[model samples]
Target: MKSFEKELPENYDALKKKANYTSSWRDRLDAVTTLSAYQHEKVIDLLNNRMKNDTVFKVQTAAYKALVAFGENVEKPTPARFDVIKGPNKIFLRVKKSLPKDHTVEEFADKLKRMRLDVYDAFEGDKGDQFMTWLEERWAKL
Candidate 1:
């Protein structure tokens, strides 16, 4: 299967075309998976076409996922909710308000600290998957 490297023009073109017009769903899947690594402007349209026109549901789904990975607005992105278990000795910071996009993990922890509650472990709500993902990503570096 061709890759998505821009240095290899053939790779980009192959993926852009195969992903949209390939006869084999397997080939289409291969192209869709590689689309995320390429940064061509037209690839978005190709993926969009795959998402909407592909005969195979799997291929269509793969295109949709690729679009999302590319940061394309396939749909509205929802903010994640931070959920903490209420505590007697352990205190969870539960904010009922909307948080700014620039809110940091340090700020989150510090808020709980100021409330004089010891954090055991923080839990995230279903809505907070993106927020938790950011935290987990930072934690991996440490």
Candidate 2:
């Protein structure tokens, strides 16, 4: 029986770009899943990079899973104590100050999206469907 090894796809460069797009954890996580289809060293290295250094825990976990699926020896990355959003309390305060006292959480979320897309994206990715709930909880505290 002849053994078959997966070859790098023509879209490898595009996938690489997605994997390295520092601003979007969703892109990086999707890239890890997409890269898992190939059995090439380049893909392995890219997954390794994400596993070791992605600021988002979800992206890092996706990369670790991909590498494990590829039969690579890797330790699971620790869950991040903090999210990619630095000083979220400060950001929340800024957003609060920008809004009227009677502003809704929806308004706050919209303002956050407009003001700090990085923070918005991180929370959205991290919280998934619970993003709104989390936002409301935080807003209540503010």
Pairs of colliding residues, candidate 2: none
Position 2, candidate 2: lDDT = 26
lDDT of 2 at 36: 80
Tens-digit per-residue lDDT, 1-142, candidate 1 = 4345454345677676666553346677788887756646777777788777554556667778777766678853222233333332223224212234466656654554455332212222121346456544533333
Q: How many backbone clashes does candidate 2 have?
A: 0
lDDT of each: 0.54, 0.85
